[model samples]
Target: MEPPPPPPRWFQRLDRRLRLSPLGVAWTSGREMELMHRAMGFAALGFLTLVPVLVLVAAAQPSSGHGFARWLGQAIGVTHESQLQVERLFGVPNTALQRTTAFGLAALAVFGLTFGSAVQTGYEKVWDLPTARWHTMWRHVVFLALLVGALLGFVNTPAPSGDVTGPLTVVVLDLIGTFLFFWIAQHILLGGRVRWIALLPGAVATTLGLLGLRGFSQLVFSPLIASSAVTYGPFGTVLVVQSWLVGVGFVVYGGALVGRLAHEGRVFRRLKDQDET
Candidate 1:
């Protein structure tokens, strides 16, 4: 019986030039979510807090093939040359275990828990949920454990061959695994307040974004790694890796944002939701 109200004047003018009603909502949402800032936070916390724990877990596993470096390589899909650079950047597993002390191990675990909390906070923000109670710390512990197990399992996923089935199988398995991970992650991290169906779009979007990032890494960061290593040495390598991590952060939150937009039917309103802020 009624037409949709006209979009705000700002959107009306901008839409005329660029027809950006679709993308405009995303840009505005990114600002509202502090998306980039949260992503950078993810990169920093992931590297500083969680990585050491992962390095140890990867190295400690009796079956660890290439250790953490191998997992990192697969996670980001680096080129062969870039993979070598990453291997050199991190210490070997045995040496790490040898150098580690009980107190140090405890510290790493604590730091890992903190990293989980940071991610939980981000998820809460996405759903406009308030922070969970302190007693929920156990959820962080569980999430950290699952994350490590999942990553370790990922590195062990068999390499694909030249045959059609091999690649297809690998792709199918990856999609399933990654999807399950994010899907479960949201449920656990958000304390299960958000329904599984509500979280599905974010999980699927994140998985696709990761697949795209892997291809982009092969084309872009793979070369940048070689050059950065030559120009900036190990520090250069760190820079490239950090930049990649930022991309990961963007995708993680971006996917959830997209899911939220779809659920709320805010995909086309542009600035109309300004009051909702």
Candidate 2:
């Protein structure tokens, strides 16, 4: 593999402030990269292994997923009955199995790449190193599956709630889960070893960013979607796509902030020593 290039002169100049960013912490902490790699492998494995568990748990309840789906569809102007039909189409025993398999495979591919990219980013930052070969990436993939499975089994177990609150809660939880997944992916990509507490800062930053985006979207875009007559049509699709982009912007910015924080911390420490002298 080729040696990773050093950061450009501009980034180097801002290195102190960057340490406080997620990317900076990732870059500075080689151990974290290794942890991230391992955790990613475990997470993928967890996705496959936990499908049955999640399905079983979900199936046992009989009413959880459909309820949420129904409520979402209605809130979005999709009639409750239309939502029910969609659920039924996917819920047949055979169909559900196939859906689960397809979902698992897709997740494995999506997150495998996602975690790997994060690892590559961190590896580049810390050591000026490039990613390892596919074999190395595979090792990380396996590690991610395991790590993610454990986490889902623990933190993500569903709570039975009929109250089914607002769209904002749904959006918030979705973003929170996304942040957690990315945080864990970073841990796995690094090597499945990190201080769990180290994850909190990144998660906190990400969640806050997501919430802010949510508020902005509600204020600026919700009415446009709400006022539309088309449900499950091209107009609705466009609205959903637009909202997704807004959310994604927040997530990407949050990640960049993570990188910057780490860079900043190192610069601060170095300067403090010079000042002492």
Candidate 3:
């Protein structure tokens, strides 16, 4: 077949303009990953599997009397009224622990492994690595254990609402904790195929994204929870929570995608220049 004709000047200019910018590069990469769809999948799998496991983790914590519901409320930055609604959803920690059984825990763990697998797969795609083998289930297990631990730490950390330093303290702690978790998580899930330096940008990006999401949740979901509960009862509240999960998924994957482009410095180069290099 004959080679395709060179692009028109206008077309070339438009392409060059987009490909040379970081935002444009992000847009392109996001489309390739079907980023929104991937985020939805992350949210769906995380909700169905990881939430149950986290509930158990919350139940197991002696310090947290309010249980998984409290964790959920804090994560989404809700106010006291909204947090109360959430506590009602899951009941108290003792109640949650009372309901737990060996068989039930095992089942939740098995399902939670799938959530870890999904996270691993997301990392692989971001790095363009081949899928890890079935034997790699051990990594998933470890990842899940660490995840539970990280969350437990978050749940247990006390940030008194009335303290002047409470908000600042939480911000600093969240930044450090989130950074370490994602940086280590990428190493673990990628099986260390990627170097720490190359993965650093992704972790930073993901952490910033999470922080931004937390801020947004505080402004939006905090009030939404109270109102939604009144309008649609528990189901409305559930919808708001699900929406937050979707945002979380979007940030986790989208941030990594942004970081990959940044690492390559492709965001600084035009498409034709990149091709030549």
Best candidate per TM-score, number? 3
The 0-to-1 C-alpha lDDT of every candidate, in the order given, reads 0.83, 0.49, 0.83
What are the models' TM-scores?
0.85, 0.47, 0.87
RMSD over all Cα atoms, model 1: 7.1
Error of 1 at 275 (Å): 25
Question: How accurate locally is residue 93 in candidate 2, as Cα lDDT from 0 to 100?
Answer: 46
TM-score of candidate 3 versus the correct structure, residues matched by position? 0.87
- Candidate 3 — worst ten consecutive residues by lDDT sum? 263-272
Worst 10 residues of 2 by lDDT: 67-76
Error of 2 at 219 (Å): 2.3
Per-residue lDDT of 1-277 in model 2, one digit per residue for the tens?
Answer: 9999989988877877798565566556535545444434434433334334444445445545543333223323344344444344324243444455666667656665565455445434443445555555664666456544543443333443566565456555666666676566555554544444555455566656655655665454444444442454445544453454435433443453464464456668989999999
Q: How accurate is candidate 2 locally (lDDT)?
A: 0.49
CA shift of 52, model 3, Å: 2.1
Q: Tally clashes: model 1.
A: 0
RMSD of each: 7.1, 10.2, 4.5
Better of 2 and 3 by TM-score: 3
